[model samples]
Target: MMNKPYVIGIAGSSGSGKTFFLKSFLNHFKSDQVTLISQDDYYIPANTKTREENRLYNFDIPTSINRADFYKDIKQLFEGQTVFREEYTFNNPDLKPQMLEIKPAPILIVEGLFIFHYTEVNELLDYRIFLDADESVALDRRLRRDLIERGYDEEDVMYKWTNHVVPSYQEYLLPHKEECDLVIINNTDDPKVIDEAANKISVELHEKNSTLNII
Candidate 1:
């Protein structure tokens, strides 16, 4: 049997530096040898029924994603096979059916809030990382990103964070931290910590390869 590629999962609260860590790790590996699979891509289309119930559209929790497709894509990555998948654009309800012809890369990194939330994805990872950030810091980052990029105002952003993001983080994201192989606290601007964590993961992967034939 052929050796399966290493699978890594990076989970975190919003704006907790998972993206930075992922980029840092990618820098260490050749592009052909690494592929990034984000849970953000698995978000479900906004249902008017659900949106009306909540009064706000949040793509943060488990139900936000298309469970069937997400599980299937994770399975493909875990098997060292390729899958063409959809990219989830925030609040875009239409599915255009664009296919990205993905080849199986040797290192697969999956990052998101709910990657660890679901059992199928959790089981597929060889190693997992959880990002820990202070609530204030996370909120500040979210506010800035939403206001500048997503066209949300300060009052609405603050209200959304208080009501939706923070509570969801505690209830859904925090409890799953213990499931990860490592938990790193994210620094807002300075990514020294993110780089360190990525380096450590590289070292650990190398060590595992040398000792246990864990390719």
Candidate 2:
């Protein structure tokens, strides 16, 4: 049986390079040694909203997530139960969502914009990492991602950035920055810094959990 996992909570503002950092971090270990539970998958479906209304819907707030269910699943994982979740596709018509099977591992990573804000989820985190970036840099990355990947127009992206994302970051995420065990500032285009940070963190985690085999 797997021992109690060392849980890591990762949070950042929108476009703070979390996706990139996570990709780098996961590379250090075999897939079975680590499990990732992303808050994006726990978004409450807004099927009633029209296309135009969907653009106006504020998904940046903590209320937009099914926090109760998210916490329950995490608890189940801690109890050595495997969890299954439907992948959230951002309402993209062309993308087909998959069923994600998450098994308990020595290292569990919970990532989201509001993971730190949700009190129950925050309490489960053994370590916390916050990604930081300049406002202009994050805004630019958000614009490109929403426009190309999510099929959002420039106007809608800017509207959400100004009205929803920025406010939520200030109110929910930024306040918890100092509480994090590690803070990574990712402003430059080069991702080498992120890889280096991930390597260092992974080494320490492996040292703590000696059962985790390095790949």
Candidate 3:
């Protein structure tokens, strides 16, 4: 992979503090060196809307997204070519067709629940990370966020997590943690945790490149 961007994936069951870990990684590096792309940003609008309507969507599954769009974004980044990124709308929480400048940075962090399950997404990654978190805690956090942000009631949020998210995480996300460069069991609530991870990431990258040179 000549001139390829160094892609790192941070994954966990929803509410497993994947965001928290990503923020921590960001803290170590300056904005110019690190850019973040999330799988949530590439979701299929129709499926998300259906979930919003009948709440029948399996959000935790990798199939929740349109694979074609996901492949496009990753291919552009993987090839070290610049591309624009679309952000996800929380109000609608649907995928928006959008564009943002993406350049080759020192590190590119991609976080999501299903990052590994998607073969194309995984192929682009140089490093992968998974968070080990308790199911009850993850569910509670999901409930709170859904109620406050999405206007979903407690019952509705619980239904999706139990039916769609949890099962999918077990069946898909869990098995792929082994593919990552590191596995983070998120237990800290401190802001410093991110700093620590970022520093470690830098060191690991250095070590990897050094070994590659030795080859």
Candidate 4:
């Protein structure tokens, strides 16, 4: 019988550089050693009402995700089942979504803004990591991403940032941050900081996995 995969939950505010950190961390391991399941892909499709309402949908809220399905998929992974999901394109018509296949591995990483907010999902995490950043810096990063990658206007981005993102972050994410196993502050442009954090985490995870006889 195979040992259950060690599950890690990574949470942070939007534009907190979680993607950049994850990329650096993954470089230390082979493809088969770790598998990542992101909550971004589990967003519920926005209804016609939201589209007609000037696209003011609050995606930053926990209800925007299909939480039941996300939790079910994680349980399936723990049961040694492979799961497949469609990539979410942030309503970008220019980008085509791809079919994502997630295989069970020795280490499973669950990343998102609200992973810690969902009770069932939070309970499954063996380790939790919170990525911290200054509000101004995160907002700037968010603006660039929404403007360049998602093709959003400045007005819309600012509207969402002020009305949606900040509230949700304070209510859901920040409250549980103190309970996390690790906290990484990523407010700087220096790649060396991210590299050092990733290297330390990689070494620790390797040691833990070895002890569990799962690597």
In candidate 2, stretches whose alpha carbon ends up further than 4 angstroms from where it belongs are 211-215
Q: How accurate is candidate 3 locally (lDDT)?
A: 0.70
lDDT of 3 by residue, 1-215 (tens): 43555678888877767776776667655566667777787666553255456476655666667677767866766666676766655535443445667665656777777778877778778877888767777777778778886666787787888788778888988998787777766554565665576678776665665433311
Q: Can you list the residue pairs that collide in candidate 4?
A: none
Backbone-clash count (model 2): 0
Worst 10 contiguous positions by lDDT, candidate 1: 46-55
Full-model lDDT for every candidate: 0.74, 0.90, 0.70, 0.88
Let me know the TM-score candidate 2 reaches against the reference structure: 0.96
lDDT of 2 by residue, 1-215 (tens): 55678899999878789999999999998888899999999999986789899989999999999998999999889898999999998988878899999999888999999898998899999999999899999999998898889888899999999999999999999999999999999998689988998999998987876454433
lDDT (tens digit, per residue) of candidate 1 on 1-215: 22566788888888787767788988876667677877777776564445444346665567877878877876776676778876654543443446565666767787777777788778878888888788888887888787776655687677678787888889887998887788898855787878887998887776766443434
Q: Compare candidates 2 and 3 on TM-score and give the better one.
A: 2
| CA error at residue 149 for candidate 2, angstroms | 0.7
Give the top-scoring candidate (lDDT). 2
TM-score-superior candidate, 1 or 3: 1
Q: What are the runs in model 3 whose C-alpha is more than 4 Å off?
A: 47-52, 90-99, 206-215
lDDT per residue, candidate 4, 2-57, as tens digits? 57778889989888889888999888888888889999999997634444354588
- Candidate 1 regions exceeding 4 Å error are 47-55, 92-101, 209-215
Best TM-score among the predictions, by candidate number: 2
What overall lDDT, based on C-alpha atoms, would model 4 receive against the true structure? Answer: 0.88
TM-score on alpha carbons, each prediction: 0.84, 0.96, 0.82, 0.95
